[model samples]
Every structure is written in structure tokens, then in C-alpha cells.
Target chain A: MNSSLVFLIVFGVVILAVILIYNGIISRANAAQRAWANVITQERQKNKIIPHLQTITDQYQQFESGVQEKIAALRSALGGLSSEKMDTAKLAEVESATRNLVQGMHIAVENYPELKANELFGKLMREIAEQQENIGAAIRIFNQNVEAFNNGIEMFPHSLVNSLLNKKSTLHTFNDSEAEAGFDYKPNF
Target chain B: MDKASPSSENKQLATFLQSLRTQIYHAKTREDLRHVLHTVRSFGRPLCYNNTSYWLGFSMGILLGLLAILYAYWYPSSVSAPWLIGAGGLTSVIFAVLIYMRRSKVSDLSDALFKQDVYLDNNWQSVPYHGKKLAAQLSRQFSEFKRGNHSREIEWLVKGTYQGTDHQFDYHAYHFHYVDQRQVTSTIRDSKGNVRVTTRTVYDHFHRYGLYLPFRFARNIAITNSWFGGFFSSSYKPASVEFNRKFKVSASDELSAAKFLKPAVVVEIEDLGKALSGLNLEFNAASELCISFEQNICQWQRQHGLDEPDAFLQEIEGDQKLATLQKTLERIHTLMRHSDNNF
Candidate 1:
């Protein structure tokens, strides 16, 4: 109840609040980055399957010229990709090229029943579908983390703490279209 | 294979059960009863205890102890404590005496009769299928089915082939039961600060319908409702917001899990969860597809005590039981198709 005692108690409470909020903000920011890293990992996995797709398609004469061009475009778009930064436009470009190549193969497989039934072709298509699944999951996780981070830095008491100490900005989540495109898998067989 | 039509299998089973009930009622001696019991055992492995007499005795003792506690409240507090203790000892003697009177009466034949009914109803055959082997295999392959101070058994297992439009697979369907035991210790302190520690054993019993299909999946995925979600742990999350909210999905491989849990599969599983509580599906790397649900969709009824010789047999509505089971199987078949249709 004394003046100095009251002052000390108030100071201690304020310091604890600040420390808690600061830790929360830092944790959310780190989680968002980790989720983005996972997305990058899945994207790299997709890239690794491109050569296998080309090889099998070529063997069956299913590789169209347009498909080859899209594969090249995909490589170029993803070549300068870095986990240190996120570029949505470049990611969109890589996704579009990948879709075109997959769709091209789908058309070719539809025209040839034997090629569609080939064991290796079936395995490669499964692999592509698997990569697409992982990519969708990763993107959704990243968006969830981004939403959490934004909520942490923009909410009431946390916002006051963030502005005064951490000075973090709100993050934008991935568009719904990006996640939806990954799930539109159509197998010819 | 029977020359009779599948539609008449139920009526034939019902007639067989009626004759079996008569034989049970007419059996005069323990030897006669044992002969009838052998006839029942030819059907399937019964999930019942032959040493049920011991359980009856133990239960009688507990009942007497509970009555003694009630008597203490009714009588005066000044009543001697040794008298009450002597009564408790007397109850144990009575329990032992009752257990010794078991002479394989018609009443003692309910357990075997129930098993016979289940096997006949499902057209399931009794074979030398080891329950412990399957439990150990499941524990070894899947983290969710890991053995943790639990005893498991699979009984009345039926093996058959299911021919789907796109694939044909062999399936093993059975009754799966496991009892989880935990030791709970509590400390009690009196006004004088004297502490008493007591340890009690607690048991949780789970009865489930389990099916195992030898199908290889791209990845191992575990689907369970929110209630049992904490029991499983995984780094991967489903993309659908509705699924993520309704169920807990996890897998060892992210890609395989996501691919296995397509949007259609997610919706089907979620709807199944709403229909059947405590439903769990696990697809493992060992090419085993295991599905278990806690609901008794088969509607099996067991006679617990000495009623009429035909009490349990009369309750065996095979047609109704098979109809419900078929509906559930169709739903599960739909789920399997949805998972495959992801590609």
C-alpha cells in the first residue's frame, strides 16, 4: 500500500505483460516462416518429378511440344526461387506451367489406352498427384500461420505491445485459388 | 455352400437355433451339456469366459459389501464393528458356496449359444485365427494402435474377398476388443495430518468392429474425431477447413496423407463419424487398411442370465442384423472408393 511498493508492483506487472506479448509475436512470425519453408520443400519435390514425367512421356511418344515448352517455363520460373523470400507472382507462374504440362499429358493419355495402362506411366501420375497433395497442404498450413501471425500483431493488447516493442507488420495469406488448383486432379484412366 | 437360397439361410439358421435350444433344455447331466457345448463350438470362437463362475462369486462379494455399507447407515452407530466385519466374512463363504453349485445347467449355456447365433447370422466360420498375433502386428505397424498396458482380442473373424469395380481385395472382418488399464493413486490426509495413500486399478473397455484389407496405400493416414484426436499426433493437417474443424487427420508422410484424404473421402468420413462415434481408420505402409468403429451396427444381443432356454435364440433376428451391417458396409465401401478416386 506504500507509494514505492505500489510503483514496484505496477512495474513488475507491465514488464511481465510486455515479455509475454513479445514472445507470442516472435513465435507466430517464426511459425509463418517455417510453414513457408515447408511449401518451398513441396515445390522443390514437384520440380524433381518433372524430369521423370518427361522421360516417361517421351518413351510413349506422349510428350507434346507444348508440354515440353511448359516444362521449360516451369523450370525457369522456379530456378530463381529462394526460401529466404516469397514471391506470389513467380509461384503462380510455376503453378500455371505445371498445370499445363500435367493437362497435356492427360490429353495424350486419353488418346492412347495402352500408354495410359503402362505401369511406369501410372506410377508417374501417382507421384505427380502426391506432390500436388503435399503442395496444397503446405500452402494451407502457411496461410493458417499467416492468419495467426496477423491476428497476433493486429489484435488489442498484442497490437499495443507489437507497436511499442516488436514493430511487426500484418502478413497476407495465400489466395484460395492457389490451394484449389492443387486439388483439381483428373486421371484419364 | 448351401443348396438352399441365400434368402432362406436365415430361416434355416432360425430352425437350427430352435433345435439347439431344445437340446440345451433337455440335457440332464454335465456330460450331456458338454456334448451340446462342443456342437456350439463348431460354429465360431465365442468371446466369453468359461470361468464366469469365479466372476459371479466376486460380484456377489462386492454386492454384499455394498449392502453392509447400507446396513451401517440403517443401524445404530453403537453397533460393534467386529459384527459387521464378521458379516463381511460370512458373505465370502456364501459366494464360494454358490460357485460350487454350478453343474452346467441350461443357464450356463447362454455364452456359447450367443456365439453360435453371431456366427450363424453372419455365415462366419470358426477357424484358428490368432487374436494376439493381429494385435501385435497392429501395434508394431501403427502408432495409434500401440499396446500400452492393454489386452486385445479379435473374435468371430470372417475372411472373404470383396470385388470392387476397379479392384478386388481380400478383407478380414471381426470383433475387436481391448481393455486399457491404468493405476490411479490418491493421497488422503486427515485433520491430524496423517496421510493415507491408496492405489486403485482403473479399466476402460472398448468393443469395436474391425476390418482389415490388404491394400497398399500411398501413405499412412489416421482419421479420428476430435474426442480421440489427442490420442494421435501428426505434423500434417488437412487442407479443408471443415475437415480440420470436424476431425483430426494425421500421417507419417505428408504427401500420402493428403492424397489419401481427398475432399470426397473427407466428407464421407466426417459423415460416418456423425453416424458412428469413435470411428478410426488407419492405412499403414505394410499394405493394411484397418477400419474400426465403436458402434454395434450388427445389433447383437447377448443373454446375460438364466432366462428361457430360447431367450437369446429368439432375439437372434438375423435378417435385421444383416441389413444394418450391410448398410454400414456399403458406406465403408463408398469411403474406400472415394479414397481411390482421388487420382
Candidate 2:
């Protein structure tokens, strides 16, 4: 084989390899960005539940105390929300408080047996449950993104780029107990 | 005419005087005085019954008579048989009388307890009654004794004292002492402190069980130290028995993956594409080493005319630096698990 022909073939192959690597990197970076956005979306959905919860709970003044206290605490923690540095521990506390408040409300409804059968309260509870599920889904997506980002920075070839860019992967996680238990709120009279 | 008029007037006057004297005499008898006095007393004075003294005297008399009979029976020969028998009959009569008296007294007290309108006095405390039945009845009627709430509060007060005979959880003892707003202090101590006290509210206590019996059982268990004995006795088994039992091992391929791979590798390569993107020349050095090692394996396979060259290539490619890191992590995990199991 001629030297010029060999050089041409080798050069083409290298170009194709570089393009493939670049495309893979770009697609991964985009996915990571999308995942971060999802985390924010979930957090917003969680926040939205607070007001509706408050409104529904307004009818039940006695039951509102615990729920209100938890909501206030959660709001304070989430005030300066940043997806880049979400505190896993704080999130866990918020999640737990939310669950306990839900339980408290459920118990309170037992006093007024008719309240459990109230259309508004029932709808509100269902909505809150759905919102919680959505938040969980969002958190999972965010964690998935974080895992991808961390992998890219730590994997071969991409690790070199990650180091050069000085980019660190954020940890996105939910409370293990909460995730396992799945929003337990049992009512007893 | 004058003589005849004077005789009739004189005869009429005598008859009138005789009738007035007879009526006056008839009104002053013993029965009439007695009736008048009774009426006066009934209207003027309150009916007085010394309940405490009455009961005490009656009970003491019965006790003394019983003692006398017992003494006579012990020294039968010292006393005449007829005399002893007579005394015994007399004692029995007294005893029967005392019992009747006691029952009537109790009935009177019960009526009083029921009829008396208890007002929340300035002290905000209930007046202590002499009779137990009276006190209990008064407490029920006057105290704000709602079934659920009051029972719950009382349960909280009595939780560790009552243990049910069934279940291991019942065999725990608890002690609780608290002073209420009335300054009435109560202390419940379970000498056998085997009970596990829980923070479950009174509502929960009842809701968990259908009736008060189970609740009482749970409470007694909480209060008693004997609960542990009961708990263990109900399900007594030797350590050897537990050890002898074979654990069924269910084969799970997914679970096996968790056992083989290091946690770090699974965690790091969870997003393989992103990890590859993050890697640059420096990070790729590890991958290059892996690739070179794989290439050598491939070359060796080619020279040897190995039928499964691709399989060997896959094995080499899959066993990256991440896998090595995972293996190290796995070793640490295994060591931790072993320590935990030993503990």
C-alpha cells in the first residue's frame, strides 16, 4: 500500500473517533442538565402542596398545629433553594416532618369521624399523595442525573475533561426510610 | 211566772258548765301529749345519724362476739356445754343483727352519694367520702368522666401496672408517678420491671385492641417486671434449637450481582455515558491501560486460535479500573458484614 493512501485512511479514522467521543460527551452533559431541572421541578411541586395543605387544614384548627409547624420549617429550609447544593439531611428532615404532620392530621380527623368522609379533605389528601409521588419521581430523576454526571467526571477520557473544567458532581438523594415506607398515614378512632 | 223562769235558767246554766268540764277533761290524755311532742320534734330538729360511729360500733361488736365464741370453742371443757351452746347462739344472733345494720347503713350512704349534688367547691377538689362505694359513685357522677378521654388519661396513669397473660410484649413492667392539678399524687410501681413502656397515647392503646382487657393486659405488662418471664415462657426455645434450624437459601441472580460487584463501581458507573464524558486524557490513562490489557488478551487469543476470542475480549474490557475499585470496596463491605454478623 502507498504511504499517502495509508495516511489518508488513518486520518479519517481518527477524525471519526474524535467526533463520536465529542457527541457522546455533549449528549451526556445535556442529560445531566435536564436531570437538574427535574429536581427543581419536583421541589416546586412539593412547595405547591404546602398552601393547599394549609387551606384544607384550615377547616381543622386543632389538627393544623403540627402540620403548620412542619410546613414553616420546610419553607425556611427551602427558602434559598439551590439545586447545585441541595442538603440531603435537611431534605430528609423535611420529608419526615411532612409525613408526621400527615399522620397527625389523620389522627385528628378520627375525632370528627365525618371529616374523613368529607369530599374536600379526601380530595386534598389524594392531591397531596399524588404530589408526594411526583416529588419522589423528580428526586429519582435528579439522582439519576447526578449519577451520570459523577460517572462522566470519574470515567476514562471524560475524567480528563472534568478535571480540566473543575466541575464537581452534586449528590441528589432522598430519605431512605421515607422512600421505603411510602408516606404512611394511618387513622384510628 | 217569775219563780218558774228562774228555775229553768238555773237548770240550763248547770248543764252548760258540766259539758265544758267533760270536754276539757277529755283533751288532756297521755297519748295526745305524746303526739304533740312528736310533731314538735319533727318540725324543729334535723334527723341525726352518726354513720361512722354506727358502722364502727356494729363491726366491733360482731368482732368481739366472734372472738368470744372462738375462745369458748378453744377451751370447751372449761365451760359447760349448755352455757357454751347458749353463748354461741347469742353470738350468732348479734352477728346477724350487725350484718343487717351494716347493709342498711351502706344502703343509706349509697342513697346519699347518689342524691347529693356535688358542686365544684372553692378548693376545686372533691370531698373525700367515708364509704368506698359512695366515693366511687360520687367520682363517677361528678367527675368529668367521658369514657374515651378519661379512660385514656387513666390508662396513661395505669399503663405499666396491668399486664395481660397473653403475648410477649405484655411481659414488660413500667412505673409512673405524677401529681395532678388537684395535688393528689399517685405512684404506680411494678416491682417486676420487665415491661417495655411505649409513648403510644391512650387512643392508640384502645384502637390497637378491641376491648379494655387487652389494654389492661398491655398496661400490666408494661408495669410488671414479670412480663419478661411471661414473654420468654410463652415462646421458650434454646439457642441450640435456633442454630440447628437450616436457613433456606433462595437463589437470586440480581442479589448475586450485589454480592460480586463493589458498591463504588456500581455507584460510579451508574451513569456510564456521563462518566465517559467527564473523563479527559488524565482519567483516560486508566481506560488506556484497560484497553491495552484487553488488546494483549485479544492478541494472545488470535495467536492461540482460541474459539472464544470475543468472550475473552469482553471479560478483559468489562474488568476495568472501576471493577478493581469495586473489588476493594467489596472486601471492606464483606469485612464490615462479618463484624456485624459476629456482633
Candidate 3:
């Protein structure tokens, strides 16, 4: 009976440890998903300001169809934004496109000196900058979560728990080749 | 030239430094410590009376400088214009020379600091130090310095090991230049004008200093700072009303940063951040922590006669440099103790 009791106690400790480790992995994975969601939220925030920006652009901008095309592309990308939905390559394309569109809009505005000094345009730009910053911050957060989750799954002891969960690594990275190839932006008068 | 035997002075210096190292950390053996301190000096500067001469010279220089300024102001018409300017320039030059000469003398406290660092370095070498450029890794991932010019300088370095990892902490000053680089095309193209499109890269630099801890991760991890975060900053919003809102951590995933920023890591990082006095720990930069100090690390100051052999011994009780070093080491230890948990 004493031997059986010892075996039971040992079994109980092992079970408790397994529960703790499994819980830790699930918690981290959930966090990664949440951060990815936040990235989407921030990107959408930036996207919402684009129409406001376009209203101003339509009033002042002349012969800057390049900007409109870029804006349309960015708007299209934002339409499909969702939590943990875009793979690494798609994410890279979206990020690059977003930056280019924002910059192109600013360049197009430069062609119109009056718009450059317009108070409404200035306010919209500030709002857009804030939104873009929020998106940048969210991406960093998302990347951090993905990395930590992967680490948790990859590191020993934790790796054992991760294997039990049957989870694989999901990298959040900038696709340099794709980003460079897709990005062909130039400002001309 | 002498291989087997050393001068008695060198031997004594080595022995003293070795003893000091053993007494403090006991991380190295006597034989090993001795070997490590070979030809190292106990005092980088000889202790001496910080006499009234330095003060007298400084005062004389200041008085002369003032007199020149006063003459230029009050007696512009009293003398010939050239002579007036000449007298003023002469005094100013003398004072400038004196100031230059006075600045380079190593202080008593600096000597002590050097000796202390030497011993610490010996122990660190045994523990095996680490040094790395952490931001270099992020440069590839982001376009932070792509369109413009950027430079990074390691201003100061401190190193130690914790949680079975070697880490070298650095105080870095970074300068970034944003320029409008555009291709300019000229209509006047000649045989010599093969370079039709000229690219202009005009750069102006803005610098900021931060404490950088670069360490290799056993596995992949990413952590970022939240929009409303930071322990002691003006733009602070206590999201959820918690006093422990020093940092808002976000992992690559939902709960990754929350789990990684464990109570142990948070408490330790908080203590370290607070002890840093002013630097705000930058959590969003990368997984490797970077605390933006916004100023230079404590530069070795002019000793203020604190290390003078002839100064009042009682006044020497507060060795400011040594105290600063002690505080810095303690904070660094606290920071590294829980660093491995994050990534």
C-alpha cells in the first residue's frame, strides 16, 4: 500500500507539471494571435485615414495619377487585413506597399504648394503618421510574440510540451526579395 | 626585455590587484589572477597633493579673461583700437592655453576607478566577456537607415554573465541623417557629361544615447513595447490603473510578452530601470533590450581634488566615481539576471 501511495504521488507531480507546461504553450500561442490581430487593427486604422487624405488630394492634386494608383492598392490590401491571416510574404508586400503609398501621397501633395500649407492636410498627415506608427508598433509586438512562441516550442522541456501540442513555427519576417522586386517607386514632375 | 624576472614595483602592483580581485569576487585562483594582472598597474595615476597652484592658475586665467572683456567694453576709446584688441586677445589666448593644460591631468578618483576596473576586467575575462552590435541585426529587417545616413558608436562598455549566458552591455550614441536623395537630370548633355543623372545625398545628423544589451537567444522570440507604456515618462497612461505599469510588453503572439515579462523579469527590469536614474528602457526596438538614456554614461569627471593625497581625508569618504561604478554594476546584474527569460 505504501509503494502504491508513492507511485500515486509521483504520478500526481508529473501530471501537474504537464498541465503547467501545456498551459504555458497555449497561453503564448494565444498571445501571438492577439498581437497579430492588433497589427491588423493598426493597419486598418491607417487605412481608414486614406479616404480623408484622398478628399484633400482630390481638391488640390493635379497630374498625380501615380499616387491614386498606389492609394487604391493600399486600400485593397487593407480590405483583406485580418489577425494572423497573411503569411510572411504577403505581410512583407503589404508593409512595403503601405509605406510607398503614404510617401507617394506626400510627394504628390508637394506638387501642390497650397495643399502643402493647408491646415486640414497637416492634421490629416499627423493622424496618418500616428496611425502608421501604431501599425509599426503592433507589427513589432506581433513579431515578438511569434518568436517567443516558437522559442517556447523549440527549447528543450518546453519542446516536449510543444510537440505534444503539435504546433509548428510561424515566422513573421520581411521578404527582402519579394519586397524589393515589387517595390518600384520614383517621383517625377 | 626581462622574461623570467620582473621589477619589484610591477610585482607589487600585480600582487595588490590580484588580492583585491580575490577579496571581492573570488572568481579566479591566485595563480590565475597573478597571470591575468601581469604588468598591470594598481594606480593608473600617481596620488599627489592637488595643490593651490591649479586653482591659482584657473583664477588668474578667469580674472584675465574678465579683464580683457571689461577693457573691450569699458575702455574702447581709452587706447588705440588695434592695441585694445591686442591686449584682449593676448589674455584670452593665455587663459585658453591654461584651461587646455588643466583638463588632461588624471584625478585621484580616476586612478582608483581604473584600478577597480582592471581587477573587475580580470574576473570578467575568466568569466569570459561578450560584446556585440545588436542594432546591426535589426538594420536588415527595417529601413531605419536605408534612405539616409546613420552611425553608431559604442561610448562605454560593461560585461558580465548571468543565467548561463555571457552578455556585454554597451552605452551607445546613434546618429541618423535624413536626406532627400534624388536623381537630377541636366538637359545640357555633352561627351564629358556621361553622368547625366546626378544623385545628391545631403545628410545632417541627430544623436541620442542608449544602454544596449545584446545577447544571443537559445530560440526565436520577439517582444515589443505597447502604445501606452513606460514606467516614468510624461506621455504615460496607466492602462488598467496598475502601479506596476512600468512597461507595457507585447510578444509576437498574444500572451508571449505577458508570459515572458514574468513577475521576476518585470521586478528585476523595473529595479534596473529605476536605478538607471533617467534612461527609459526601450522595449519596442528589438528583443535585445535597449534603454534610451538620452545622455552620455557617467563620463570620468575632473576629480575635484577628491583623490588628492593631501586633501582632507574625511572629505574623501564619498568617492563619487567609485560610487557610480558600484551602482552601475548592481543595476547591470539585476538586468541580466532575468534577461534570458524574455527571448
Best candidate, lDDT: 1
- Please identify which of the two predictions, 2 or 3, would achieve the higher lDDT against the true structure: 3
- Local accuracy of candidate 2 as per-residue lDDT tens digits, A1-189: 999999999999977765665555665556655555544555555676677677766877776765677777767765645666456665566566667667766776876677788777776676566446545555555566556656756787766655555455534445466565666764351
lDDT, model 1: 0.64
lDDT of 1 by residue, B1-343 (tens): 6474533554454454556678755654444554554565464533222445455666666666666677777774746544655676677677666544433433444755555555554554555778878767766765445534678766557764545544566666777677889999999999999999999999998777766776564446677662443433464564444456557777776677766665445555656777776777777777577777777664555644323333333354323235655555665665555455332
lDDT of the structure predicted as candidate 3: 0.49
lDDT of 2 at B4: 33
Cα shift from native, residue A66, model 1 (Å):
2.7
Model 1 pairs whose backbones collide: none
DockQ score for model 3: 0.01
> How much lDDT does each candidate structure score?
0.64, 0.38, 0.49
Candidate numbers, best DockQ first, in rank order = 1, 2, 3
Report, to 2 decimal places, the DockQ of model 2: 0.02
Residue A18 CA displacement from its true place in model 1, Å: 2.7
DockQ-better candidate, 1 vs 2: 1
Tens digit of per-residue lDDT, candidate 1, span A1-189:
799999999999999999999998998788778767767766777677777767765776545555677778778877866777766566666677778778877877777777777777786777677567657666776777788888999989999999999999887776646556578775463
* Backbone atom clashes (below 3 Å) for every candidate: 0, 39, 15
What is the full ranking by TM-score, best candidate first? Answer: 1, 3, 2
